[model samples]
Target chain A: MFLALVSGNPWLESLARLAIIAVLVPVTVIILTWVERKVIGRLQMRLGPMRVGPYGTLQGVADTIKLLTKEDVRPQTADRWVFELAPFVIVVPVFMAVVAIPFTADLFIQNLTLGVFYFVAVSGLSIVGFVMAGWGSDNKYALLGGVRAAAQLISYEIPLVMAIVAVAMLSQSLNLAVIVGAQEDTPNIAFQSLAFLIFAIAGLAELYRQPFDIPVAESEVVGGPFVEYSGIRWSMFQLGEFVNLVLISILGSLIFLGGWQWPWSVFDESVPVVAQIAMMAVKTAAFILFFMWMRASLPRLRIDQMMSFCWQLLLPFALLQIIINGLVLVYDWPNEILIPLSGAGAAGAVYLTYRAARATGVRYQPGYQTVGSVL
Target chain B: MTYEEVIFYVVAVPTVVGAIGVVTARNVVHSALFLILSLLSVAGIFILLSAEFLAIVQVLIYGGAVTILVLFAMMLTRVRDMPAALDGPQRPFAALAAGAFMVVSIFSMVSTEWPGDTNKINVISIQQIGNDLFTTWAVPFEVASLVLMVALLGAIVLARGEEGE
Candidate 1:
């Protein structure tokens, strides 16, 4: 149906594809918002959104309507142009990043040869939007949140990109389909588990989800960069975030979980598009659920702690994974060799994190007796 | 005009306007935002030229990291406290230096006889670039990285000095 309609005109075809994404993304965000509330509620031992549609399925819809109708407010002191444009800066890049993401082998808006690189680069553009929102709002809290968001996002991006590079090296391709196809026999996860770990951690930080969500910590900077946003403007920020959540999940599944190929590859040539999509959905869903679960279970980290963790722990481990992969590829070693080496790195990361967590309690420094005494 | 020409103008207009805005904007943050605009549009030009890798790198480093660093400094230093921040007594000398630099760059750019097809976009694959970097240009690549490492260390030292003092 789509192919026939979009036949002949590249312009029309792109418009049609974009339209589908534009419509589909919001619907997904709505469903996800409801799911997140329900999941988090379950984790906390309570009913979530029970008053809306069946089991609160319509809660997201209700919230959407509310957000759309809410009056957009602008503070008099705010930088008018910057404040107005900030949300777009934050939102548009995320939607653009969605363009190259493949659901099935064939289903994508545009599959660039540089799909992984394009996604990372485009997503990085959103950091400027956070800063814009922070500075434009003219609110101290908003400014602080914006700064935190920028720092956290920028720092975590290194590890995330490094992890993705490791996978790209193993696959010897940057195309999403090529990467997934390369994993037909054994998923990249088996060889690059350490990269997977780094990707997950860095992905969580990128999403500004819990534990790493110091930028938007309610107790501190009170909603971070979006503190001043309301109505449809604010909804745009929320949309960017959930879309980002889906993007990261899909990318993670594609790079590390073997995308649509893994368990279903047994059928190989006979696997239907529906089946392929279903497999992709399952992995993406698992990632989304894991993100939500982490949000519910973990305490938010202090900004200092989060930054230190990314730089001191995650960055080093990610680089090590890349180095190890390079060695294996250069030496023409068996792919199986990656397992033990990557596993050792993964173990080392976990142990270091464990030690760091244990050692982070309040301790007295020698020269700071007065400050230490209070603690 | 061709589609490529159309696309080039679309991006090129913003690149020029953004460059102008960076120097002319009253607010320092506005200048940084304009700088991002300029950088991003240049990335768009890279896409027009079919250098997707270089385009993305431009967006990632210039549009993303460098501009954010500038904003961070502006915010941390409380740039708003000073009125007419850019209107310093050194403005004349700065403008003269900038004008001279721009003239030299444009002269060099115009004078150079560029190689490659003028009509067809030369598509360079990532693999080709990687092979060249590791094989033909390996020493220069390593030297560039070494320079960056030294700069990184220097930044750390500068940042660390306040505590020591």
Candidate 2:
């Protein structure tokens, strides 16, 4: 990093940086997931598979070995190359996202001129992997699920971008760490809460959890896109998902709550590295818990309902939030109008959204009639 | 070779080969996959150029989103309907167009000198672009946003397919 900065050669520096993070990011994701599972297990009042080795420290290692040694299989009718390549599609984009995410002010690896736009933009790549997996698997369920995920991601991405744009408008920055730092210094959640809400909601939708996970609704699609995957190949997809959870948690802390830095400028540079990691981990843990909580709480949406919710409700709300945020940042709005307007907007949006779905909510009771059945 | 030349070759070669594969490959999936390789190589070039933001955006948007959307469409429509992969067919004037494009691009590259010394990439933040977007280029920014709004609506409409009553 020092050499790249001093010598003015970007290529060598980027290569050097990528090599370091390629190992670093994946390692962090693995260890953190083990921790997440342990926490969740305790939350669920279960022993959480603690029999591996000493507080189940080797639980993940044991599971990994089992998955690794498992048999590899392909469906008889499946396309060979694309089936093999599906997991790579998912892995590469997540790896690429690391470039835009920064740990500290000076500790960033890939500093894009476009900043967070790079982060927002590159997110679309994973859809390819999912979609390809479904179609390549030669299974109806997989293909349908992939198509569903594709729609879900693209639709939710609008709100996600809009929410981020609101932040960029307010702070006037696109760098991930810079966004977090701005929040840490200014502490403007009072005004930015709307943006935060929009971001979180949209973000969860993007992650395809709970209400948004229709594509992988086990009962709906029978294991969805990964139905045909097996052995180490399936493990790659699983690992990618775990990495995604970590990345999204890091992002939540980044864009909404302050990332690694604490409020009030409390810490000095003299603090130890583990302490920094611990602080970041605490913030990240809160986010992961929120994610798992949402997963446990919400019921999955039907495809049309999910699609309409995003495009009609979340999209407009996100647009309005960005506009209001832009106005405040550009020419400070009177608190009189600003505060209540945001609250009313959020409440009204939610109420209308819920009401809109009320009639649609009546499900086909297992024996009830489903829509689009060719008699 | 100098460091710049080495970087140039590293980025440029893959991009060119990938571009060739994207066009020449008969299979639509192969074409799409090759397009990803092409875009990824361009992203590598952006990294080489020290435009980290641009490189990441290339990877995220072009690599992540666009590629995924294409795959989605491919999945929804056809999986095994890839007769082109088995039998290559010639496109009308494809050879001539490709030749012309390559010549023109190389000529442009050779003709244009470096954008002043061709080798300084400051690791600036998103703040700089934001400032530029809102201040010096605010008019263009608003106009561009309006254009994006139209594009967004157009995409939604196109995706939905017009079977309006």
DockQ per model, Cα:
0.68, 0.44
Task: List lDDT for all candidates, in order.
Answer: 0.91, 0.74
Give candidate 1's iRMS in Å, 1 decimal: 1.8
Compose the digit string of candidate 1's lDDT tens values, residues A1-375.
768878678899889989999999999999999999999999999998899878988899999999999999999999999999999999999999999899998888998899999999999999999999999999999999999999999999999999999999999999999999899888999999999999999999999999888888889999988888899999999999999999999999999999988484568476788888999999999999999999999888877678778878898899999999989998999999999999999999988888877774675464422221111
lDDT tens digits by residue: candidate 2, A290-347: 8877776677876877777777777788788877776776686653455666677777
What are the models' TM-scores?
A: 0.96, 0.81
Looking at model 1, residue A246 earns an lDDT score of 97
Q: Which is the leading candidate under lDDT? A: 1
Off by over 4 Å in 2: A1-47, A54-57, A104-115, A185-188, A264-275, A333-341, A353-375, B50-57, B82-165
TM-score for candidate 1, please give it: 0.96
Worst 10 residues of 1 chain A by lDDT: A366-375
Residue pairs in candidate 1 whose N, alpha carbon or C atoms collide under 3 angstroms: none
